[model samples]
Target: MTRKRQGQQGWGPEHPEQHYLVQPRTVAGGGDVRHVSEYLRASGWRDRSKRGGPLLVESPDRTLRVAYDPHGQPGGWTIHGKATGSTQEWSAHLGRQTPVEIVAGITDTLPLPRSAHAPNVWGPLADGGWHARFEGNSYSATSPDGTAWLQYRQEANGTALWWTGATDTRGNSWTGAFTPTTPLHVVQAFSAQLASPEPVMRPRGRVPHSSKIRTWSVSVTPSQLGAWQQARINAARAATWARNSRRTDRPSTSAPPYANAGSVRTRR
Candidate 1:
């Protein structure tokens, strides 16, 4: 169990190797926004982040605005993308607890071309044995253990949403949502991770676990954890090396729009 340092000297890549801790269901504590801030800087997003201010950046086109100011704003992230150049292009405000990996899933894919207009959002959750229910224009899904849920509504209902959330056995929950303008593929990326039965690793001291409930927990030998860590390190190095080889140095554009009011609340 070790602490993950912030900033991108070498501290990035989508998945950092998991440790002994489990990401608690009730509170959003384990993920780091730096995982994303660093990627944005590397992928060519202009690092306009001022010292002692919220981490900030913009796309080359200047349409997308991503800001990470965890303390100044407990919301954690504000992603704005105006591909359509409309007031409603797309925007998402992610809370402090939203897992950085899932956020990466959506943001990282933004620069890629979207040829497949329609993506299957439910398939991944279904594969994971999550149940789906649809009534009229509203659609939703929930995890088998009843610790997570996702919903998408077609009609504009004040604030647009693609809520993806998970709860721990104790009933605590953390949530992240994207707007309607956001790509389904992007939303799917978030959904797919939530649908995953894979355990989320954290530092052992920080995990929120009751004496007997550990459905999301897994035991790993030190040797196994070590090997897995080294492999991930190697992969990250290879990726960085390849990027350096092919490109000059510049990061790029990312995830998107809409804003009003939202929150992450634990279930009592």
Candidate 2:
């Protein structure tokens, strides 16, 4: 007898690829360029420019591609990818939102785990406060309040069972299990368990009083004050002169004339 992999029992390789196409509520413009650029960069898309055409953004692996037109048809960015299902997944992730909303969405959906990790199966959660890490069939997450772990087990019948466990700051422990149909409930319970009360900090020692201290008073004549001001100016000029002289005396490290003969020097 042979054993089937945990997640591969019911899953098939020819599953329909997920595709998403998000049309902005408004046309792409200068106002949202930064946001779009950031999303593309974070998603591992690089700009591929060509002669006499719009700019193309492609994934490093060449599995995904995107193009944007601020003034052309569609009036927004168009995303496409191979049958890996990432194209639709990214499109759905982008969702139906205005430019600003999409930017916020991108900001929230970050620090995605590697493809081999369980997070790739669980996906990003609604809660953004916790930091998550994965190892093999188990994953752990920690927030300001507490920490939690989720582990997967393969039953004899090829049914996958997930065990959700957590411990709060108050020394309370909770554990539960769920099938694939109700996995979100496990996540919700885990998130609730992680919502421990915030800690309060109190000062430990009495602050020192400001009154009990020795004092000394000195007065400078007008001439002395004038001399001090003149000294400061002279020191500043001397420092500036030293810096300029050091720069002037430094040896030239420029390349030979042939290397940069065609380069133009612009006025400072």
Candidate 3:
């Protein structure tokens, strides 16, 4: 997207969808954590939290850890993992300034195993018809309307930062950044959301990096809420039904288990 200048920062009194906006209360605003955390617990990861400390969870093998500490230096959210009994280790972090929605992109895919095929960060952008620019190890994709963008700098060791952002003609913008090792699910989640054409429901509150007066927001209606919720439920049910049907078609020895753990527990 072209650099939106810091000029007049207000949308006209017309269609709110025509302008870029921030909605913190909506799933677009990073509201996926509670559900994902519950998913993790149900999928055999242990809740390792202690009173008045960072909310903590650990993989069954004790090699992976996710922590949320308000006072954590450089970043308030961190995920660190190490191979059991080996020196190999990697970490991904998101600063407090990072959008909650973007953070959800990283956490939502933690349960499954990684694919043998490397994560193709560009594939989603290409499918979305965004203009892509590539150079040695750096790449970026900008939305057709110049309202959203994704930037990546790849390193063999997966430490380079990748940025995702949105902007409007009003100079209002939002951004979140993470390392290449942030997890493939995060990349997919961010890409899927960016490519979707639906609207986000946001409650009234100040956005993180932009002025509230600069963008437009409307109260969420009951019908809108019910419709969105029903859609979500139906989509999930369809997915489950399809998966079960496929399983029945063949004699399957096994499939990926959530976190590959049989049970979850809290620390004694």
> Higher lDDT: candidate 1 or 3?
1
Q: Score candidate 2 by lDDT.
A: 0.36
Q: Which candidate leads the pack in lDDT? A: 1
- Tens-place lDDT per residue, model 1, 1-268, is 1234543343443343323333323233436566566655555668888888887888766878887767854557788888664344787777666666666666665544453457888888899888899957778988776766888866656654687666654424467678887767767766766665444454445555543224233344445555544544444344445555874332222211101112212221
Is candidate 1 or 2 superior in TM-score? 1
lDDT of each: 0.59, 0.36, 0.52
Candidate 3 weakest ten by summed lDDT: 250-259
Sort by TM-score, top down from the best = 1, 3, 2
- lDDT: the better of candidates 1 and 2: 1
Instruction: Give the worst 10-residue stretch by lDDT in candidate 2.
Output: 199-208
